[model samples]
Target: MAGGNFMHRVLSYVINEVVVNGLANSPAFQRFAVRTSKTLEDISVKASKKRQELAEQIKEASRNFDSFKN
Candidate 1:
């Protein structure tokens, strides 16, 4: 029924406004967001370092193969 649909929309809007806006207004949530961002950045940097190391290892291996052909 139309009444049920109206109530559903109203309830959904209230929940979105309260939960989303409330968390954004909270200091604890802000701290959590900062920590999560830092952790992700650290992981990204570590991964990039590992990738570069692997690339260097591959280059060294390819050189070994080239030297063997002579």
Candidate 2:
């Protein structure tokens, strides 16, 4: 168990070190960061539009129900 734990820690450390070095010095990582940010922004916009459409649908349903009650 202890040996496994030691190996896991060493692997984590190495991965973290590599990521830090890459972010600081790698042009590829820079492009990756930009692309990731743009993708996230696109996702956000699509989510917002879907939310608005759902809200409108709920409002229409509520209005129809109110009209039927009268």
Clashing pairs in 2: none
lDDT of 1 at 62: 97
Whole-model lDDT values for every prediction? 0.99, 0.97
How do the residues 1-70 of candidate 1 rate in per-residue lDDT, one tens digit apiece? 9999999999999999999999999999999999999999999999999999999999999999999998
Measured on C-alpha atoms, candidate 2 has an lDDT of 0.97
Over 6-52, each residue of candidate 2 has an lDDT whose tens digit, in order, gives: 99999999999998997979898899999999999999999999999
Predicted structure with the largest TM-score when compared to the true one? 1
Q: What does candidate 2 score on TM?
A: 0.68
Q: Score candidate 1 by TM-score against the native.
A: 0.82
